[model samples]
Target: MQKFFAVVAFAAAFLTAWTAAPDRAEAAASRIKDLAAIEGVRENQLIGYGLVVGLNGTGDSLNNAPFTKQSLQAMMERMGVNTRGANMRTANVAAVMVTANLPPFATQGTRVDVNVSALGDAKSLQGGTLLVTPLLGADGEAYAIAQGALSVGGFVAKGDAASITRGVPTAARIANGALVEREIAFKLGTMSTVRLALRNPDFTTSRRIAMAINDLLGAPAAEPIAPSTVRLSLPPKFNGNIVDLITDIEQLAVEPDLPAKVVIDEATGIIVMGQDVRVSTVAIAQGNLTVTVTEQPEVSQPNPLSQGETVVVPRTQVTVNDDSKKKLAVVKSTVSLRELVDGLNALGVGPRDLITILQAIKAAGALQAEIEVM
Candidate 1:
């Protein structure tokens, strides 16, 4: 009877241990659109120097910004007014720098929004109009031209000895203010092969992606060139147009490897940990120490006949409180993420406390992944 009781106890322990282990399928997750990226698609930045007119006496002062004066002089010359070396003071115009992004494969005559910022000491750009300005590319070539009325989302009001200014005083934007004049040269169908670059490169993820592509379209269709790049042969049908091929390839699903990582935002005290994070058996003790100082003022009056001066004295009181006698919590080796979270949560640690704990864990060679703080 004693042997049978011992055997039953052992069996129960074994079953409990087996059930405690986390299921691999439930823990395994492939981030949505995490490993996929478009081939040969990108955005180009376009910039231009322009002027914003129609300001209500809040334009750039010509004395401070000489560039604004020079620009205005040059613009006046084009209109048959030769103002060379002329000291002109105008409060209706403000110098602005215009910027816009040209999307990939943007056709001619397509309109895009442009951002305008005051480059001088303009108090406000409200109700200003941006003149015709030629937008230039990185290669010093004109790509688009911007011209529209400014839509400053702010206002300023002034009265005698008082003024109220609200919103941004230097920046504004114009909707559909730029027109594309040229197309970026990008050949997508000329090559018989194309490369797919992963947004986040992982060896395991790259292998899985290559395998999935090969399985979908035989082994001869796709090959893994490196851990981050996969080369694919263009099918005869897609050789004429590559857009359809990209659309189909991006929809293919593949299981991705979860990276062990811990991210902390120091500004907001946010801590994020991956599911694969594990912790070794360690003891953690947390306590608070506070020191407070207070001051009390006292006044002493002069005696009536002693000719003594009145004086004020300040008294400071200081106190220190330490809570180091709290119980130290011990956590055993955690094999899974849920266990690690549960153990940490049981210690009543907040986000800031968790950040410290993670840093300490990483320093002790227990955390297996990279720690990033932003």
Candidate 2:
């Protein structure tokens, strides 16, 4: 009797652990750098207006695009060419806008890639050379200059009847095309405090990140200010230097906690469920009703000797299918994503049908997860 009681107690303990395994598996460890980013360390956008030349009769029509004509004339005047009143009808030049991003802490003389897009009614920008354009930041200050030959990903070839183009011909990119001239002043080492912004904001994730940092530094250096922000005060040993502190804590690993969410793309019939998604006890029935109609037209001819004309006759056939073999399936309470998916699959419905069933379940208060439809 003693041995039997001991065996029963062990089995109960094993069952309890097996039931709680799904909850423990949901919190997977993620690196701190992947969960959050250092505040103020980001890229800035720059934009400029310029001209793309050397197109083979695919440039914008000067008659329709007045801005292109005016810009060309202005450029000619700058080059000491007199075109103020001249009839300049050029089909090899197109007006374009240049754009690029300035990486954080980028110094002078560093080169960055630039994207060139046609601003006029140009058919294609292939084999075009971008002229010198000054890229300006949000402060209306010139930060970089971009000039290079464009590498268009697509081309347009027409023979009066048909044309085949693969990619966007009006947009192009130039690798290492822009040279950084002015620097955006930022002193990273002189900061007293730094904030880490969470990419996916959650209160639990924020607290976990702070705890991870505190464990690594052996001090109360990191504090969660909001769901999305974790501010860190400079410890005494760091001596006003925040770069080393960031470098040390950004590599620590912590488990990020996220809320249970189910995302559904109705257009594409795609469903994504979180690991913690669960459902209450519910019964689901899925079946499709199909009705088919077919038409067959026939002509009836009279005998050769009879004085009767041919008559046309129409025939129609119809069939209905209700999928009577499918029956209602019941899904008990779920504890994991796999169990939930298995329960839904037991209804034998496709993704499109599953989308409707999920919505219905949510309406019935059986789905314990939030449903997001796209």
The TM-score between candidate 1 and the true structure equals: 0.86
Where does candidate 1 stray beyond 4 Å?
A: 1-34, 157-165, 237-240
CA RMSD per model (angstroms): 9.4, 8.9
lDDT of all predictions: 0.79, 0.89
TM-scores, all models, native as reference: 0.86, 0.89
Error of 2 at 61 (Å): 1.0
Task: List model 2 lDDT by residue over 1-374, tens digit each.
Answer: 35433533464455456557765544467889999998999999999999999999999999999999999999989999989888878899999999999999999999999999999899999999999999999999999999999999998888888988879999999999999999999899999898999999999999999998998889999999999999999998987899989889888888888798989887766677776788988888888999999999899999999999999899999999999888788888875666666666666666778789989999999888899988
In model 1, state the lDDT of residue 108: 98
- Candidate 1 residue-wise lDDT at 179: 99
